[model samples]
Target: MKDYMGYSIEGRTTAISTILNQYSSGITLMKQDSNGEFYPLKAKTTILPNGSKSYILTPCNQ
Candidate 1:
């Protein structure tokens, strides 16, 4: 989420889409809070029961 908040991926291996999905609505993709700060969603792609990739949003945007 820190990387997303900064908008600078200095050392990022996970895809932006993945991170977004992991965080879900808890974190904003490009929206700012009342404090005018970006809390990026921490999303990731996981293997589904059907042998497919599915996005899983984490409990929090951490």
Candidate 2:
């Protein structure tokens, strides 16, 4: 993973797909809340017709 000033940077050249697929168990997706706190990010992936995948990250309840 690459970081720019304490933030994870995702770019076109980054191989995120492989990382998300192969090492997803180690990754805990997160989201920020209105109170300025972070929580786990729930998501689901769907396969497209072109053999590509799309992720739908569900909103945090709190």
Candidate 3:
């Protein structure tokens, strides 16, 4: 076991969960912490053209 503290933590330890449930629906968003990590959101969903659905997730401004 090595030192696991602060920003030194790996992905699982440092991952951040930022989700948009209302708009995203089945989709989820994972945000990285200051250290730059990753975590699973949840799942992806596709909507039919006839269905009244819109993607809450959009391109990042930055």
- Across 1-62, the per-residue lDDT of candidate 1 in tens digits comes to 44433444521323554654555635344535688776554445667798976544442435
Model 3 lDDT vs. the true structure? 0.37
TM-score for candidate 2 = 0.38
Clashing pairs in 1: 18-43, 19-43, 22-42, 22-43, 22-57, 22-58, 23-42
Name every residue pair that clashes in candidate 3: none
lDDT against the true structure, each candidate:
0.49, 0.50, 0.37
- Name model 3 segments beyond 4 Å from true: 1-20, 39-62
lDDT, candidate 3, at 29 = 55
Report the lDDT tens digits of candidate 3 across residue range 1-62. 11221343332232222224434546545556566775444322346589743222222332
State the local distance difference test value for candidate 2. 0.50
Work out how many backbone clashes candidate 1 has.
7
TM-score against truth, every candidate: 0.35, 0.38, 0.21
Best of the candidates, TM-score: 2
